[model samples]
Target chain A: MAALSIKDLTAIAKKTKESMQISAQGPHTKITVHMGTCGIAAGAQKVMDSFKEVLEIVDKKDVILTYSGCAGLCSNEPMVTIERYGEKPIKYINITPKIAREIMKQHVQKGNPLKEYIIAKGYENIV
Target chain B: MGDSTMSKETKKKEKTQTIPDLNSVPFFGRQILIALRNRGRINPESIDEYIAHDGYQALAKGLTKLKPTDIVEQIKQSSLRGRGGGGFDTGRKWASAAKATGEPKYVICNADEGDPGAYMDRSIIEADPHSVIEGMALCGRAIGSTVGYVYIRAEYPLARKILGHALEQARAYGLLGENILDSDFSFDIFIKQGAGAFVCGESSALRASIEGNVGEPTPKYDHATEKGLWKKPTVLNNVESFANVPPIILKGAQWFSAMGTEHSKGTKVFSLVGKIVNTGLIEVLMGTTLRDIIFEIGGGIPDGKAFKAVQTGGPSGGCIPESLLDMSVDFEELSKAGSMMGSGGMIVMDEDTCMVNVAKYFIEFCNSESCGKCISCRDGSEAMLEILTRISEGKGKEEDITLLEELSNAIKEASLCGLGTSLPNPVLSTLRYFKEEYQEHIVHKRCPAGVCKALITFTVLEKNCTKCGVCFKNCPYEAITWKKKEIAVINQNQCKKCGICYEVCKFKAIERK
Candidate 1:
C-alpha cells in the first residue's frame, strides 16, 4: 500500500463521512447496538441479530446499522439507540430479542418510539 | 421536501413525549468524554469510521506541523500525569527519554491491566484502539523511537484481537509503519501478551517480561526512562494515558488542563463495578467528588443497601468509608484519604460487606501475587494474610491490629517493587477507617455484617417470614424446610451458611446472627 499524504488522510475522512450520510444532511435512520464485553455477556449479539432480521424484512435501504463498545451503563446492557435523521436519538435499555424486534418495527421503521423501554433521548455532550 | 416535513412532525412528537434527555440524567450528564470520545459512537473495527471522527488527525498534525521537541513541550505544559496510578508527569518521562543517551529507545504501552476488578484498559483497547495507537505514534515522534510494544494480558483475548486488527489497519493506511502519513519519521508498534502474573503490571517486571526474562521487578534505582527494555531508554505509559495524548495534541494543552484539578489535569476513566446500580465504564473530570461519582453518576449502591465503603484503585488501593464520599477524586486527594488512584477501579461495597473479610480478601490477593523477591513482601504479606484470616474467622487477638500495622509499615519500607509497597493499602486503610468494625469482631466475637460464616449463624425470623417459602426454594443446601402457610425452619445441622438463602429472602425473614 502506498503511504498516504496528509491531504489523503483528510480526503478519506471526508469521503467516508459523505458515504455515511445517505441524505443531503444525514442518514435517514441510524441504529447502534452497544456490543462491549459486558453488552455481549448480556446477549447484545442476540439483540443485534434480532435487529438485523427486522431491518432485512423491512428493507429500508437508507437506514444504517452499526455496533460500538460499552456505553457506560453496563447494568442496562443489551441497549440499543435509534436515531431518525433530524430527530433526537432515543436510547432503549434492558433490551431483549423481542424488544429489539419491536424497536426496529415501531421506532426504526414506523417512526414511533416504544416509550416504556426508552431510557433517555438525544446524544451525550462529547468533549 | 417530504423528509423535512417528516422530521418536523417527529420533533414535535418528541417534544410532547417525556423521554428524559441524556443531559437531564445525571448518569450521562455528569461525564465528560475525552479519552472515550468515540467509545460508543463509532465502529471500533473500522478505520474509516475512526478517521471520520478525526482520529488520526492529531498524529498527522504532529508529524507534519510540529517537531519532536515541540510535541514534548506541549504535553509538559498540559500537566497530564500518568493515569497508570503513579501520577508521574508524562512529558517529563518523554523529555528524559528524548535526552537520555541510548540508541533504539523504545516506547512501551502498558496494557497489562491486572487489577482484579479493573477493565478500564481492556475496554479502551477494545473500544478505541486507534486512539491509543495514535497516542503511541505521537509519543514515538516525541521520544524519537522507531518501535513500540503494547504488553497486554493474555486473558483479554478480545481486546488483543481488536488491537491486533487495529495495528494492521493503521499500517495499511500508512498511519503506523514506515514513513507514517508520508512524514520523514518512521515508527511501528508490536503487541506482547503477558503470562497473567499480577505483578507484571509493574513497569520493570513488564519490561523484563518483554525482554524474555522472568517477570519479576528489580529495584528502580534508575528510572525506566534511563535504562529499560534491554537496558535502552524507554518511555512507558498506561493504555489510558496513551489514549489521552491525541486529544491533547489536537485540542491543545490548555483545553485539556482546563477541565481537571490544580495538580491533575484531564479526565480519568473509571470502571465503576461491584455493588453499584450503574456498573460500567465512566470518564469524569479529575477532582469530581466521590459523592457525585457514586450517587449522581453510578446511581448509588444497588438493592437499597446502605453504603459502607468504596474501594478505589485495586487490591493495592484502599477502601474509602462513607465519610469521605464528598471528597474530591484526584491523585493527591485519593492518596491523602489513604487510597491511591490505581488505574481507576472503583468497587463499591454495601453494609453487608465485612471490613475484616474485605481486608482478608485483598491481603490474600497480594499474598498470592507477590513475586517473593524480597523477604519483607513475601513473608510480610503471608503473615498479614494469616492475621486477617484469623480475625475474619473469629480467632484474632487484641494485639493483632498493632501487629498488622507494624507489618504494613515494614513491607512498604523494605519491599523491592510497587506490588509489595502498595499491597498493604487495603489493610492499612480498613484498620484506620473501620477500626470499630475490627474491634467488634475481636472483642465481641461477632461479625456485624454477618459475612464471616464462622462468626455468624443463619436463622429464619418467624414474624417476618410470612410463610413465603422463597428461602426454602432458593436454598442450595436444602437446609430450609417449610410447609404450606408455615414459617420456614432452617436445619442448622445441614446448613452450609452459604448466604444464598439470606440473599434470596425478600421479606427480610432470614436473619444472620
Candidate 2:
C-alpha cells in the first residue's frame, strides 16, 4: 500500500464518511451491538451473527451495522440499540438470536417497536 | 376487531410507562466519555471507522500545525497529570525528555496493568487501540523520539491481539512507521509482553524488563525522563494517560482542563467491582464524589446489604469507610483520606465483608509480590501479613496494631521501590478508618462480620428457618441436618465454619456465635 500524505488523510476521511452515511445527513437506520468482553460472554457474538443473517434476508441497504464496547450496565448483556433517522434510539437488553431476528423484522423493517424488550430510549447525556 | 384495538391501546400505555429516558438512569447519566469517546461507537478492528470518528485527526494536526516544543507547551497548559497512580505532571515529563541530552529518546506506554479487579486499561486497548497509538505518536512528536514501545502483559491475549492489529492498520495508513503522513517526522511502535508480575508495573522495573533483565525496580535517583530505556532520555506514560493525549491535542488544552478540578484535569476511567450491583467500567470527572460513584453509578451494594467500605487503588490502595463516602475522588483528596488513586480500581464492600480480613488479603498479595531486593519491603510485608493473620484468626495481642503501624512506617521510609512504599496502605488506612472493627476482633476474640472461620460458629435461628432446607441442600459437608416442616440443626462437630450456610440462607436464619 502507498503512504498517505496530509491531504490524502482529509480526503480519505471525507470519502469514507460520505460513503458510510446512508442519507445526506446520516444513516437512516443504525444498529450498534455492544460486543465488550462482558457482552460477548453473554452471547453477543451469536446475537451479532443473527443480525447479519436477518439483514441478508431483508436486504436493507440503508441500514448500518456496527459493534462497540461495554455500555456500562453489564448486568444487561448482549444489548442492542437501534437508531432511526431523527428518532430517539431504543436500547434492547438481554437479547437472543431469536429476538434479534424478531427485532430486525419488526423494528427495523417496520416502524413499530418491540416494546417488551426495550430497556431505554434516547442516548445518555455524556459530556 | 374490538380485542385487537384494546390490545394496541394497552401496548401504547405500557411502552410509555416502561421505557424510561436514558438520562434518568444514574449509572449512565453520571459518566462522561472523553478518553473512552470511541468505545461503544466504533469497531476497534476497523481503522476506517476510527477515522470517521476523527481518530487520527489529532496526529494530523500535531504533525502539520504544531512544533515539538509547542505540543509540549499545550499539554503543560492543559495541566494533565499522570493517570498511572503517581499523579505526576505529564507535560513536565515530556518537557524534560525533550530537553534532556541524549542520542535517541524513547516513548513507552505502560500497559502492564496488574491491579486485581481492575480492567480499565485492558478494556480501553480492546475497545479503542488507536487512541493509545495516536496518543503515543503525539508524545513521540513532542519528545523527539522515533521509537515507541507498549509494554503489555501476556495474560491479556485479546487486548494484545487487537492492539497488534490496530498497529498494523495504522502503519498501512501511514499513521505509524517512517515518514508518518509524509512529514519529516518518523515514529514506530512495538509491543513487548511481560510475564504478568505485579512489580513489573513499576516504571523502573518495566524498563528493566524491556531491557531483558530481571524485573526489579531500582531507586529513582534520576527520573526515567532523563535516563530510561537503554540509559537514554525516555518518556513513559500509562495506558490511560497516553490515550488522553489525542483529545487534548484536538480540542484545545483549555477545553480539556475545564472538565476536571483545578489541579487534576480531564476524566478518569475506573473499573467498578466487588459487592456493587453494576460492576463495569465507568468514567467520571476527577472531582466526582465517592457517594456518586458508589451509590449512583455503581447502583449501591447488592443483596440488600449495608455499605461497609470501598477500597480504591487496588491492593496497593487503602480501604475507605462509610463516613468518607461523600469525599471528592480527586488525587489530593484520596491521598488526604489515607488512600491514593492508584489506577482507578474501586472495590465496594458490604457489611458482610470483614475489614480485618480485607487488610490481610491485600497485605498477603503485597508480601507475595515483593521482589525481595529490599529487606524492608520483603521482610516488613511478611511481618505485617503475620500480624494481620493473627488478628483475623482471633489470636492477636493488643500491641499488634501498634507493631503493624511501626512496620508500615519503616517499610515506607526504607523501601527502594513503590511496591514496598505503598505496601502498607491497606493496613494503615483500615486502621485509620475501621479501628473499632479491629478492636472488636482483638478484645472480644470475635469476628463481628463472621468471616474468620476460626473465630465464629454458625447456628440456625428457628423462628426464621421456614424449614427452607437451603442450608442443608447447599452444604458441601453434611453439617446441617433438616427434615420437612422442621427447623434445621447445624452439627457443630461436623461444621467446619465455612459460612456456606450463612451465605445460602434466604431467611437470614443462620447466625454466627
lDDT of 1 by residue, A21-118 (tens): 64634458888898888889999999999888887777658688999877878889888878887777888899999998887777776677888888
Which runs in model 2 stand beyond 4 Å of their true positions?
A: A23-28, A60-62, A124-127, B1-18
lDDT of 2 by residue, B1-513 (tens): 999989987875566567787777787778888878777767888888888778788999999899999899999999999998889999999999999989688999999898888888888898899999999999999999999999999998878998999999999988888899888889999999999999999999999999999999987888789899899999999999998998899988998999888788889999999999988788999999999999998999888999999999987799998899999889999999889899989999999899999999998998999999999999999999889899988899999989989999999999988999999999999999989889989999988888888789999998888997999998998988999888999999999988889888889999987
lDDT of candidate 2 over A1-127, digit per residue (tens)? 7888877777877887876565635457888898877788899999999999887877667689988877666777888988876567888888999999898888777656788888778766544
Inter-residue clash pairs, candidate 1: none
Report the lDDT tens digits of candidate 1 across residue range B256-320: 99989999998999999888998878999999999999999999888799999999989889999
Clashing residue pairs for model 2: none
Query: How well does candidate 2 score on lDDT at residue B119?
Result: 85
Cα error, residue A36 of model 1, in Å, equals 1.2
Report how large a share of the reference interface contacts model 2 reproduces.
Answer: 0.63
Per-candidate local distance difference test: 0.90, 0.88
